[model samples]
Target chain A: MTWAAVLLLAAGTYALRLAGPMLRRRITLPEAAVRYCGLGAVVLLAAFIATSTMIDGTRLVGPTRPAAVAVGAILALRRAPFIVVVCGAAVTAAVLRLAGLP
Target chain B: MRLIRRTVVLVRGAGLLRDVIAVASAVGVVGASFGAMAAAAGVAPELTIGMSLLVFAGGAQFLAVGVIGAGGGIAAAILAGLLLNARHLPFGLAVGAAFDRGWATRIVGSHLMIDESVAFALAQREPERRRRAYWMCGIAVFVCWNLGTALGVLAGGAVGDPNVLGLDAAFPAGLLALLLPSLADRVALRVALIGATIAVVATPLLQPGAGLLLALIALAFALPLPARRPGRRP
Candidate 1:
């Protein structure tokens, strides 16, 4: 099942990546559609971040993870390097958990 | 005049290579986290590495692993990944000229069409410089990212439960970082907020990946309203 998912995703994503270049002269996407596609990606990513950070399966993982993620978000907004943002979140979560924050 | 221009481009290319390496290193770090998180989530080492090798899109790979790890079905995982990667369509268009050499280059270049590589390519004004930036960044990132993932998978095996060290938090954190830049646009921010709210609210009620799918409803808000009623007077 996992292999199938990976293969499908790989194929589909590659197609999308290839579509624009391959069809550039053959077709032109509507301006609105293009803009929406960009916006849609942002929406999906935000949604994913929220659910993954706050909920695990059907249960809320509690505040520790969210708090750590918050730190990472702030660092990212400030344009911190990717490594710092990641390590900062991990460290914050580990420290909070160590202090019994759950 | 042509020879002088070529010399200048070559000189600039040297500096661009340095910048591309720095960006590639950052991508490598995130790639490592992805490998470790996926492995810790009980993904087979081979599968984790395979996804990194083949999929190569950090956001999509991370989303797929997260969905599957939460017990979502394979269909949901693939769907989520495809949705996250939708941006690559425009990306390919914007950088198409970089791959104009031939079909062979196009196939491999499409596979290398990542956010950072495209960004680096677009930043250059000259077509020659742009092509150089694209290939240099793409190859550098590919090599570093794969190496990093391999190292991370090995490290993940040595480590015990990922949660103890908060490695689990790293996935969401990395995702949040990715989303941050896009949030700068006002409409995108509003849509993101709405989408996030829907996902959070629907999470408990719906199955794991279903809630994330439901968030697509937020795009309705992003769509432009119909034609301003055929140009009525303001």
Candidate 2:
């Protein structure tokens, strides 16, 4: 089941990637559609970050996870490199979790 | 004179070369964490490696595994992963013009069009240099990322409790880092904020992945009607 899901996602993603090259000439997007695409990118990314940090399946994670995510977010907004941002956030969460903050 | 000209060309491309290495190493480390987390979540080591190899998008893969590991359905995991990757359409479009002619190259190039490669390619102003950076960074990231995932799978069992090390936090942090640059645009910032609000609100009411999908509806506000021409009768 997991493998099938992975494969379906991969295939769909690849088609979307390929659509730009193969379909650009064949189909020109409407002005509104293009704008939506641009905005959709930002919105979807934001949604991903929120969902991953705040939601665990159907349940919400405890404050520690969200707090650690905030640390990462601040660093990221300040333009920290990928490694520092990821590790810094991880360490914050680890420390909090170690302290038994649920 | 010829040698000096060759040296100059090399010097010009050096920044992108350095950037490729930096991106590779950075992504590689995250890839390792992803493997460790997946393994810790009880996903088999082989499947973890396979996910890295096939999906190749770090954020989407992490989201998928997070959902699946949390006992979410497979369809939910797939939907979340695809939604996270929807940005690749624009990314591929941005860099599509940089590809050389040939079905083999195009197919392979399109397959490798992840965030790093697309960003590195578009950062270059010159077409030739952009293509070079694209291929260089694309191949470098692919190899390094997969290798890192394999290593992480091998070490995953030993790294018990991925959350203890805050690996869970790493997923959101990495995503935020990617979103940081785009947020500088006021429109993007507004859209993101609105989307985040929707996701937060919907999380409790809707299913796990549905909240994120609901956020895409925020893009409706970004749509604009075509402007009229100067002499239009309307």
For model 2, how does the per-residue alpha-carbon lDDT over B1-234 read when each residue is reduced to its tens digit? Answer: 999999999987775576567567766777777888887888887788888888888877887888777788898888877865766776555567677356787788888888667655645668898799789988999998899899888887564555777877876776677567667766778788889889988977876556777887777655453343546875
For candidate 1, what is the DockQ-based docking class?
A: acceptable
lDDT of each residue in B59-116, candidate 1, tens digit only = 6887788888778878888987887677677567667877657788888999998866
Top model number, DockQ: 2
List the candidates' TM-scores in order: 0.62, 0.70
In order, the first chain's TM-score in every candidate is: 0.71, 0.74
Residue A58 of candidate 2: its Cα lDDT? 59
TM-score between candidate 2 and the true structure: 0.70
Per-candidate total of colliding backbone pairs? 0, 0
